[model samples]
Target chain A: MTQLRKALRPSTKALPEYTRGHNRSLVLQTLYRDGRRSRADIARETGLTRVTVSALVAELIAEGLLVELGQREETRPGKPATLLDLDRSAFVIVGLDLSEHSVFTGALLDLDGAISTRVEVELAGSTGDEALAKVVDLAEQLVAAATAPVLGIGVGSPGVVDLGGVVLSAPNLGWNGLPLQALLAERFGVPVVVANDANAAILAEHSFGGAASDAMLVKIGHGVGAGLLLGGTPLFGSRFAAGEIGHVVVGTDGGAVCACGKRGCLETWLSIPNLHARLDRPENADARERDVVLREAGERLGIALAPVVGALDLGEVILSGPTDLLDGALASATVETLRNRTMAEFHGSVTLRMTALGPDIVLRGAAVMVLSSRLGVS
Target chain B: MTQLRKALRPSTKALPEYTRGHNRSLVLQTLYRDGRRSRADIARETGLTRVTVSALVAELIAEGLLVELGQREETRPGKPATLLDLDRSAFVIVGLDLSEHSVFTGALLDLDGAISTRVEVELAGSTGDEALAKVVDLAEQLVAAATAPVLGIGVGSPGVVDLGGVVLSAPNLGWNGLPLQALLAERFGVPVVVANDANAAILAEHSFGGAASDAMLVKIGHGVGAGLLLGGTPLFGSRFAAGEIGHVVVGTDGGAVCACGKRGCLETWLSIPNLHARLDRPENADARERDVVLREAGERLGIALAPVVGALDLGEVILSGPTDLLDGALASATVETLRNRTMAEFHGSVTLRMTALGPDIVLRGAAVMVLSSRLGVS
Candidate 1:
C-alpha cells in the first residue's frame, strides 16, 4: 500500500513530446478560457518564446484548428499583431443526450458550442437495445448533416459512466457494462466521451452556464439527478457515480417507494410525474394554484438538499426543469427553504437558479466533453 | 457576472520567474512522486533533456535538497548511472494541530514525514489570545529543536479557515479572523499554510496514508467535521469551506440541536461526547454491552452519512477518533448502516477504517500542506 501510494504521486512534464503536447494544450486552453489572443499574448500567457508560439500557431492554422481574426492594434506596442482564434466552423462535434423521457436526441455542435444541426427519434416505448439503436440512428442523422469533419461523439446518458467510456450502469436504458464509447468510436471513426447526463450538464454549465468554480446542477424531470463540479472540474467519484443524488432517501416518514427500494427518496419527491402526483393536479389549475403546488415541491427538494449544501459548502445550485415551473415560485421557495436550513454563513449566498441552457444543456455538455478530451480546451 | 467569471478563469503560467519556479517544482515533485532516479531517468520521466535535468539536479544538490545515492549496476544497454534522491534531512517542517481537546501540540517533521521533535502546551484555562499565544510558544520550541533549516510551518486548525490563513470563527478557542498564517510566517520567516484541520488530515492521508483518489476523512472529537478529496485533490469550495459537515441535519425525528442552530445535526450524534452520552455508559461493562452501545452510536452516524454517500458515491469513509470507541462493533454498525442506506451499487464497497496516524493525523496533515504548497510534492 505504501509503495503503491508513493508510485501514484504526480510529476511534472518536460520531455520534448510532453512539452509539445503541453504547449499545444496551453495555447488551445488559453484561447478556450480567455477567448482570442494575439501571438504575443499567447506567447506571454503560455511562457513560450515567440518563435515556439509562432511555430505552434502555424501548425494549428495549417491544421484548420485555428484561424487569424485580423489584428489587434496597440498604441504603445512596436507593431500590430494578428489575433488567433478557434475555427469554430471548421469542425463539428456530435452530442447525444439520452436523459429525456421518450426521445433519443443528437445535435451537431461547432467549436463554440452552438448547435448547428439537431436530430431526434422518439423511443416509442423502446427499451434496452432498441433504445440504444435509436440513439445511434439519431446521431448518424446529425453526423450526416454536419458539413465539417466530426471531431468526436459525446453521449450524455443516465447512468454511471467511467473514464474508459463504458456505461457501468444505466437503469433507465437497462444498460450494464455497455461499451457505448467503443461502439460509437468504432462505427463513427472518431473519439467518444460517454458521461452521466447530470455530469454532462455540469460540464456544460462550467463551459457556458454561469457556474462558479464550485457548483452543482440538479436536473428534475423524468428522474431527478445532480451533477457536481468542484474546484473547476467534474467530481467523478470512485465509481464514476459522484452526482447520483436522485435515489437518496430524503425523509423518515415513508412515502412512495423509489425504484431502488428506498422510501421517500429525492427522486420520489422531485421526479416530474411524482411531483405532479404529489401536487394533486387540480383540473385546469390556474397559474396561482399551479405556483402554490410547485412551490411546495420545491421546498421539499430544498429540505432534501439542505444536507448537501451544508456538507459541501457549495456556492450555487441550478435547477433544470420546465421553465414555468422551475423558475417562478418553485425557485423562490427552494431558495427560501435552503437559506433557512443551511448554515447562517451561507444564507442568501447559496444562489439557486433555473438553468439558462434549457434542453440543450446535456447536448452542449457532450460537445464540451469532446472539446476538452480531444483538444484539451475547456 | 460575465466579466467576473472570466476574471476567475485560471490562466497558463508565464514569465521567466514563473517558468523557473514551475520547472524547479516539477523536478522536486518528480523526486517526491517517482522517488530516486538517475538524472537521465528523471530527464526522460519529466520530458526534460539530460542536460537540463543534470543542471537542475546540480542546483538542488547545492541547495541541500537533493543528494546522490550511489550508482546503479549495469542493468541496461548503457553505462550505470548515478541516482539522485531527496535529502530527507535537508530541511524541517513545523506541523501544528489545534483540534486537540486540552493542548496545542506542534511537531518538527522531516521531509519523509517523520516526527523528529514534539512539543505541547496544555491549554490550562487559556482562551482567546492566550490560547493563540500558547500555540506560538509550542511551535517556537519545535522549530528551535530542528538542526536543519526550517522549510515552513503548517497548521491544521479547527474551524473555517480561508486561503489567506485567517481563522473564521473557531468557537472552541474563541478565535475569529485571526491571521494565523501571516502571524506564523512573520515570526518564523518562512512560508506558512493554515487549513481546516479536517482538510489537512485528508491531505495527510493522500500523502502518506493509503487513501483512494476519492476519499473522505471524518474527524470526530470536540467537534465533528469531514474533509473530502475528489479526483486526487481536496474539494475546496468557492469560499474554501467545503466538507463542513458537522452541522448537517441527520435524523427526521430530531434529537438534539447543533451549535450551528440546526436540529438533529450530525454533530449532535457523532461528536465524541454526544455519542458517549447517548450510549449511557455502563459500569464494568462487558464486551457485548460495549458493542451494543457503540453500535447504536455508529448506526446514528451512518444514518447521518447516508445522504453524503449517495450524493458523492464515495468509495471510502475514514474515521479519526478514539480507536477503542470507533473500531470493532461501532465501525461495523456504521459500515452496515452506510451500506444499507446507500445505493446497492456501493454495497460492500464503501470501506470504513480508523485513521492510521491516530491523533497525529492533523499534525501530519499539516506537514502535507507544507509539502504540497511549498514544495508541490504531495
Candidate 2:
C-alpha cells in the first residue's frame, strides 16, 4: 500500500523558492533580450506589480548585477523613468574549452559575452587526471587575468555531462564520471558549470549568434554531434544525451566503419577526419570529384537530419565547424537534400548555414553557461 | 528605429494571469496524478500556503470540478483531514475522431477519460462541407447522449491544426483553413478543441496509457505520422506540423512512389494500406514471406526514426495501429533496426511497442484534450 502511494507522487511541484528563482530568471532574461528598461517598463512588460519590480531591481542593483543608467528619453511620458540595465563589465567570467585535440583554451569574458583576455595550453595528448589538471591550470590563468571579480567558471568539454557537471565519458580525454565542476568550484571558490561542447556551442549560437529558439547546431569536428534548443530551452534529454546524433547510422548502403563499430554512422559520413579522408583519396583528385564527395556527405547528413527536422519542426540547422569544409558544396547539398527528403511545405524553409561565431563558439558558449547559471541571464 | 525596438521584444513574459492559470493547473494536476488528498497535503505538495489551497479547493468544489470525500482514517491524529478529489463523473466530454477512412467516431467520456457512450457516422466519401457536417453531426449526437452536463467538445481530425483550432489542410476531407472548432462550438454552445489525430493519440497515451513523458506515438493507418510528448507537453511545432512525417522519404534503396510525389516515403513503407498491399501480393504468399515484408517495412520505419530517437533521446516509441499487423515480426524488427541504427549506450534502452489502447486511442486523446483545457487535469 505504501509503495502504491509512493508511485503516485507528482514529478514536479512549484515551491516558493522555485517561483522566486523563476521570477529572477524572468527579470534577467527580459533585460538580457530587450536591453535596458525602466522599472515601470519592466513591471508593465512582465505583468509584475510596480512594487515587486522595484524590489527586484533594487536587489539586482545592490548585488552589482544591474546598473541604473539615468532616465529614459521621454516623448509623451508624464515623468522621466529611470532606466536599468545589466552591468556588462562589472564582473569577469572564466570560460574553458576542453574540446580541441592539441590545445586547451581559456578566456575571461565580460557579462556581454565579449572576450577580455585569452590563454591556451598545449594538451599534447594528455588523458585522465593529466587532462583534468591542464583544464584547471588554464582556468586559473584566466581567473588570474580577470580585471574584475570573477563571476563563475564555465567549462565546455567533449562528453556526455550530467546535470551535476559530471562527464560520464569522453574516450579521447579518458574521462568517465569525472566531477569536474565540484573540483573547480572547490579550487576557485565560485559557482562552476560544465556541459558538452556541442551543447555549449548551441547556447552561444542562441544567446549571442541570433539563432532561432527552435534550432539545432550540428558540431562537425573531431567527432560529429548536435545540440538542440527547442522553445528557447536546451533539451538535455532523459539521459542527458538528447543531441547524440553522431553514431546514428545515416547510410543504407554500406560505408567505412566508424569508431563505434557502426558501418555507416553519421560521423563516418560527416566528421571532419572522415570527410577529409574521403575527399583526399586518390580516386577523388579533381574538383568535381571533391564536390561529389562533399555533396554525398552532405546528402547523408541530410538523410540523418531530415527526420529530426520533420519530427520537431526545427526552424534552422547551424553547422559549427570549418567554413572551408562545410560552407559551399556541402552546405548547399545539405539544403537541397533536406528539401527533397522532408515535406516541402513544412520543412523546406528550415535554414541550413555555417556558424558565424568562428572558432571561439565553445568559449563564448561557456560564458553563456556562466551568465545563465550565476546571473539567470542567457 | 521603431522596428529595431520591436525586434528586441522578448518572446514570452511571466504575466500574473499566466501565473494564476499555471498555479491552478498545478493544483489540479497534483490531484489528478496523486488521487485524493486533503487541502493540507495539497499545500505541502504544491508548496502553496494553507489559505491558498483552501481557497482554490473551495472555488473548485463550488464549480463542480472537485468534491469533498469524507475524512481520512488516521491512527494518531488530533483532527481528521477532509479528503478531496476531482468530480470524475460530474461532467461529460464529447470526443470526436475523424481519422477513419470510412467512418467518424464520437464518444461521451467522463472526466476520468472513460467512454460512457459512443456514436459513429459514415463518411461515405464525403468531402469539404459535407464531411465537416458529418463531424458536427457526430459531435452533436455524442453531446446529446451525455448523461451529465457537458464540459466541452474535442475533435481529433486529420490535418495541420493551428492553435486557434483551425484545420489548415486535410486533402482527403477537402478541408482547408476550416474553423472546425468555432463552427462546432457555435452549433453546440460549448468550448471546443481540435487537433491532429496523431497529436490526440499521443495525449491519450501520456494521460492514461502509461507512456513515458518523453515519448512518441506513431499512427499508421491511412497515413504514417507521429506525435511527440516532451517533458509531458505536446510539441506543436512553429507551423503546427511537428509530426508531419508521412512524406519523409524513408527508403534509400528507392521502392514505391508516394502520393506526395516522393519515392519510398514513410507512408509507402509503413502505412497500413501499403503494408497490407505488399503482404497480400502473390510474391508474399507464405507466412515467412509475409514476415519479410513486415520486417522490411519496419526496417524502413526504423531508418526514418533512428535520427529522431537519437536527436531527442526519446524514452519510448508507441505504435498505435492494428496489433495483428504491427506486433511480432514488424515490431521486433523495428526494435532490432533501431538498435543497429542508433548508438549502443545512449539509445539502446529506448522501448518500442504497440499501444495497449487499441482503436479508441484518438477518442480517448480527444477526451484528454478536453480534460486538459477545461479542467486542467490531464
Global lDDT of each candidate:
0.80, 0.86
Off by over 4 Å in 1: A1-17, A29-37, A41-48, A71-84, A280-296, B1-49, B71-83, B279-293
- Using all chains and alpha carbons, the TM-scores for the candidates as numbered come to 0.89, 0.93
Can you tell me the CAPRI class of model 2?
acceptable
* Tens digits of lDDT, candidate 1, A223-263: 88889887787888788878777776665556678888877
Interface RMSD of each: 9.8, 10.6
lDDT of 2 by residue, B48-144 (tens): 7798688768767766667899999989958999999977777788899999888999998887888878898999999999998888788878776
As a whole number from 0 to 100, the lDDT of residue B12 in candidate 2 is 43
DockQ of 2: 0.29
lDDT of 1 by residue, B1-378 (tens): 232223223344432222445667779989987677888788788776677778778777766778899988876687789988988877788999998878888999988788978988899868799998998898889877888777788999988899888998788898988999999888877778999999999989888889888888988897788898877878767776777777766656776877777687777777888877756666526767767778866887786677778777888999999987888888899889887766777434889998898888998999989888776787
Misplaced by over 4 Å in model 2 are A1-19, A72-79, B1-19
Residue B213 deviation, candidate 1, in Å? 1.0
Candidate 1 at A161: error in angstroms? 1.1
